[model samples]
Target: MSYELKSAGALSGGTCCYAGSRLPVRGPKRDLDSPYIAFLGGTEVFGRFVKTPLSDVSESLLKMPCVNFAGVNAGLDTFASDQALQSVARSSEISVLQLLGAQNISNRYYRVHPRRNDRFLQAQPPLKELFPEVDYTEFHFNKHLLSSLQARSEERFAEVRRHLQEVWITRMQEVITTLEGRVLMLWVRYDLKGSAAFNHEPVLVDRSMVSALLGSTMGLVEVDVATAGIEGDFDGMIMGELDFPAAQHMLGPKEHARIGCALAEKLQGLI
Candidate 1:
């Protein structure tokens, strides 16, 4: 069986203000004064097309509120730079941080737009030197630029990959340190076939990277949902034509439910 598709108009819920942060947060607004869990990450955490994200479903199962602080293409830098969002996350009883791709975050090689982490801003000195032949201005997104760079020369692109991994680790550590209370790092992927190939954009940070970055935290829960299962389980659940092409890759209701169940089980002792 598959989920019935709901029109975009039907899923429209008014936005909520998180501590005066100008960025509009998706909501069926929950009370912030009460004890709650904070969910942070990129598109999947934001639940782009699905009516109920993992955070909401997890909240229902736990009989507690979960505040979704995710944004489209959100990187570690996006959350780290937002003081207000950090304040809200610190106040939460616990946090669930989704492991996003490393490419979106800014590093020594390149910079991404602050709000729209996917948008490529400018190539720094190192990146420019690496790809002097190519015009950086021609690129719009980090993934596209990286793909082009990789296609040009895999050996040189390895250096770019290394920088991103380092930056991702450092930023993740910084975010975790800034947040108060217990923090659980969650990794959700398309399939159980392990990480995606280097040529692919998604799953930039694989299982080994996750283990290395979050050593002894004992708070990481990796969820690898089967792609075929998601497609079979949820019919017409993806976003409409107006939505970005990437939206089609996001998790559906059944996948969210699976994630929620895992979270609820994991948080049994913590909260």
Candidate 2:
């Protein structure tokens, strides 16, 4: 919710703003005015304990200037807001917007929690809390025992997922239309229990919708491998779970660097 800005003025004379709950950067001034390679994403792109930070990834990868606009606990809803859009419109030379899972987007459609005073706080609520009458467990497959089966059922799970996906698509379309400069979408998946919880379904939806939106615009770049293959070793890079030091939203610094570097390569081509 609270953000602190640090600038790397000594080295690049450019500022680097780092925000979020903890591990706030104390090194550099975030070069808000200068042309930069911007990374937009949720908590992962925010880089929980990333020693170098996602913004700094370009320094190693492309030797270019970059900044991070990712807000903690942020979803597509937050990105689609006037304030978020304005932030994108006002700054940076190139932008990378990471689209999260469809289920995570669905969670934002209904009001389920109280409002917080923060830049990340949009006016929407959690899906579960908004419709108490409807079983929230169905939506939150992570906690439900019958989650796997329920999600597999075409009649029940697929129907709800379809509606949520529609909302996701609409918001993505808005993002495509609004941001100026070269824009790329990194389709990051939601890691539940160190596994690919939503499968490739949400990633597919994001890719398809993003492609459609890009057809209308010229500067949109797409990042594949947003969702990691679950069968592979996922010991370190998993997003959720307490294995991480503090919050469930991110992983260790090592993973952040890896993700950051990988992302920088993708952004390097566009910028």
On lDDT, the leading prediction is 1
lDDT of 2 by residue, 25-134 (tens): 22344645667766666656665533455556555777776666665455565556545444644466667776665444434433321111012112234433433345
Distance from true location, Cα of 204 in model 2, Å: 7.3
Per-structure clash totals for the candidates: 1, 16
Model 2 clashes, total count: 16
lDDT scores of the candidates, listed in order: 0.76, 0.49
lDDT tens readout by residue for model 1, 1-271: 4443445534556455688775556676667989998998877788767778788889898999888988767777788788998898889888898887899898898889886788999899988898889899899988788888988999999999988988887788888888842689998876432342343334478666777757635398888764424365445354444553344456777788889889988987788
Q: Which 10-residue window of candidate 2 scores lowest in summed lDDT?
A: 112-121
Instruction: State how far residue 114 of model 1 sits from its true place (Å).
Output: 0.9
- Model 1, residue 250: distance off in Å is 1.5
- Give me the candidate number with maximum TM-score: 1
Q: Which parts of model 2 have CA positions greater than 4 angstroms off?
A: 1-29, 82-85, 88-90, 106-109, 112-154, 189-206, 216-262
Candidate 2 residue 74 Cα shift, in angstroms, is: 1.0
